[model samples]
Target chain A: MATPVMDKAQATATADYITATFRIRRFNPEESDAVIWEDFQITIDPKERVLDALHKIKWDTDGTLTFRRSCAHGICGSDAMRINGRNRLACKTLIKDINPDKPITVEPIKGLTVLKDLVVDMEPFFQAFRDVMPFLVTEGNEPTRERLQSAEDRERFDDTTKCILCAACTSSCPVFWNDGQYFGPAAIVNAHRFIFDSRDEAGEQRLEILNDKDGVWRCRTTFNCTDACPRGIEVTKAIQEVKRALITRRF
Target chain B: MSTDTSGAIDGVTLYDVDNPAPVIEPPRKRTKKTPKGGGTNFEMIAWLFMRLSGIVLVVLVIGHLLIQLVLDGGVSKIGFAFVAGRWASPWWQTWDLVMLWLAMLHGANGLRTVINDYAERDNTRFWLKMLLYTATVFTILLGTLVIFTFDPNIS
Candidate 1:
């Protein structure tokens, strides 16, 4: 005998009432036990974000559960973690979009030291950013008046300014994961911003710094970084432009 | 102030000598082998290609240079007729076709590897690869069409 299908109204109501199980990977250095993954079941609206579910779990069920969140709007660049085997912001991902009946695997981003359950030490990742000297430098006395720039000049490097300092691109890179010194995609993307800027006179110096063995030359162009960026920055194109610039000596 | 010479004992000049410290050991050289990233196998294949393509490119490029520049009395000999004459022969046609296919594929693959390593957004990667593959397909198709469809004596 065939079972009768539920009507659209009934289906919607059932989905709303269903409780989903989330299997999250947890680790704490202080615990000293082997990495143990625990499951947390929460009754939530399908529209709720994974972050919300996590908060509910933290607030009601397990105070020991830990994760990091700030600017819960995804602008702070915090809350990046591995969900369903891909790097994404927990705040941006909806539980409905993932497998809800089965346990969803959640863990911290790979290729960084795990500071706690879901928080990884972001210092090393930021250190690479600092080394890239993500700043604008100009020679001669500061202009008493505003320095003028053409509209075209501004548009040239406009896309690079969208980076949110999220480690998504860097963590997705196999090369960066293996060799910490590789400037990684995020740093190179920032370098490309100034290297191509018409007003910048430091292009050559930056290119020389990046042309070393650990610099842009290390990029194999795997395109993984591109797939991981939430900001939709064209990191590969920027890197290629940098490579061309280095080869041709044209900033 | 009175300058007094020390009693002229054995005439000796005191000197402080600084010898160059033994040449500081050079920083350890990075191994030539590609770093053992997650994809050692893939890297090995890529390294092999750089060498192999470099070799084939040398031959194909040299022969191309010679035929275009040196053979048949240099640049003036090149015209529609020159290309027709070369392609009329099976051997030359095969050579040109192989060169065309190999060079284009090699360059495209190398570039694809580069794109994957850097593009940071999912949609961006998809669209860029689409563009790359499209261009490669177009060029290969056009080249193949020209190679086989050459008409030496068009009306």
Candidate 2:
């Protein structure tokens, strides 16, 4: 279940409105060659999300302000952007959670080309995801019955399975920001999801794919990915697990 | 206004048929020619070597430091005679040899990863690694030779 925008205790109390300044990095190809910072002042309830603040700015202040957000709750992962110098789902970041007294800086996630104000070219990120062969890869004919797995076996990769592909974890990575060839943390985390699955037969192939120069070895264990994951996935730990698997040649 | 406003911000003139921005390839987009997976476990082995050698290096380095700097009159006793006495034994020679090899390889691999991470261009990365390897090999070989061929009685 989605977490309520405002808890019952807060909802019961008198709503407090505060003026929040959103300093958004604006970019439009038609306007100018250089990117510009555009700040919008909006009075909103502290319990409302950064997404709501953005919506208020777009509707009431300026229609030209561009950003990508869907499912104004956090599930869609489309709203992952750099808020206050950290990757977060705008929908998940509450105005009061971040210091409302200061201006909240919202920019596009790093390591990807910005197509517009806040929309980046997601093709490269998706390509890395595709290269890992994210789906199950069992060989031979399909069985009449479902492939059974114990609950204990299922728990091995449960943390990584929470990934929404928000590009927050991948883009927040320092290595990804510099070396584009290095498969970022998200791809490795996704690979881990299937590699540890009890029923998956292609763990070896996936390990081989990740064993390249641009694979798990590039991770410096900065833990930026773990911090950036809106789903709270332990990204660095999953990467280290993949590295250990490669070393031992075991799942 | 003239039909061609060279660098102006006019809408239609900036992107006409004759004048258009160069289209660049997206970052890290794998092409047909891009090699898929490295068919070898070279990187995996290197990574494993780092951890294993790192553990060994801790013991070797701390022992060396303790003997040379902390034990038996500290830094004052670390003279030519003290060195000669240590090298006279094959055990000390082997210990120094192993320490030299492990520490050099561990450090070289660490630097290599650093270069690979920071150096953006292919030529820059390749040349930086080349320099690192050359220096590492020279130092390791020189240290090994010194350990094996030290004539303690030459003094």
Candidate 3:
């Protein structure tokens, strides 16, 4: 229902609108005693991503600005940060998603060690995955051919394989932040991938592991993790199935 | 030409490969503990709910036990007539209804928390939550139906 003239006028209006500021949280281990916030003003197109704005700021204004980014297209799972008190991928978030008139606050995700400006240490996150033994385990000698799986069997565990290890789900989790030993959402999801897989032989052992007090039992679903996930993974549901599995001793 | 001559000849031996030493590197030590995020005021309300529900559960459970096991000369008194008599009173009906609703909600919320903490994949999370919510709704509806539509006597 829109005409070309109206679209052109709208584009012009968007381009002319210039007052935008980003309030970024900065922490320097060597110089400052505490984390401090600094604001940067830049004129940008409305269609540009928040990542682009950050890049402009780092390029033209402050050379000391630091952040991790790779595969700027959302797949690599890097550049996960807290924007306006929400965990999101910077490259995927457009400026329009946030209030341009207000000072947009950017910070690192909580419950992780901040190595620098926006980068947090992901060692602990990966360590939790390791604790869950997130790999397929087969009973005997290696198969000479591809392991045969039916369509229904493959579909059963299909939903759990889309995790990109962005840590959005894990960091949004209250239990992970509260108790470090709680194996977190991502780890459990990974475990579910193998546990539910038809090719895996370690389902019982993995179930026993997850049945520990601090394992699957610690989840108190707040749905925050589900909301914060950029990949739109359903984190809470997998945990429920795990709970059911523990209770009924069946998938 | 004897063993003593051979030992003397080995004085200038360049290499000895008898023992293989174990290579040990210090374990990778984590520098600092991960920091916990800020707690919002919402946590306080959740804590309060747990305490209140726990207290209510104690009362409901005790009353349930007493009525079902000890009152009116024990289990033999718990036939259709006894149930009908209890349901005839508004207070007893309300009590059972309240217990049913509260316990179901409490258990569901607790389980919901467990799910959020563990499920990782987006689709998995979605489907699993769907299943949980479905089961919870079904149970609640069935329970309410039974409570309100019980027939005292069937000819």
Q: Across residues B16-116, which tens digit of lDDT does each residue of candidate 1 receive?
A: 12421122111211232323234123433454466588789889989999989998799988988788888899898888888888788788777775665
Per-residue lDDT tens digits for candidate 3, residues B1-155, read 24332212445432234422222111221123422223232333343466688799889989999989997698878878888989888798889988888788778767766665556555766888888889888998898898888777766
| Candidate 2 structure quality by residue, lDDT tens digits, A1-251 | 99767787787665688888999998666544456688888899899999999889989999988888878777889999999999999999999999999999999999888877888888778888989999998889999999999999999999999999999998999888877787899899999999999999999999999998988988889999999999999999999999888877642
How far out, in Å, is residue B72 in model 3? 21
Ranking by TM-score: 2, 3, 1
Off by over 4 Å in 2: A1-15, B1-33, B153-155
Worst 10 residues of 3 chain A by lDDT: A27-36
Model 2 — TM-score against the truth? 0.88
**lDDT of candidate 3 at residue B34, scale 0 to 100:** 28
Question: Across residues B1-155, which tens digit of lDDT does each residue of candidate 2 receive?
Answer: 35532334545335334544333233354433457776887888888789889999999999999999998899998888899999989899999999999998999999998988888778988999999999999999999989888887884
Give stretches of model 1 more than 4 Å off: A1-17, B1-155
Scoring model 3 with DockQ, what do you get? Answer: 0.02
lDDT values, one for every candidate:
0.75, 0.86, 0.75
**The 10-residue segment with the lowest total lDDT in model 3 chain B:** B21-30
Report the C-alpha lDDT of model 3 over A108-215, residue by residue, as the tens digit.
887777767888888878877776778888888888999999999998878789888888888877777654556678888888888889999998777776766556
Give the chain B TM-score for each candidate: 0.65, 0.81, 0.64
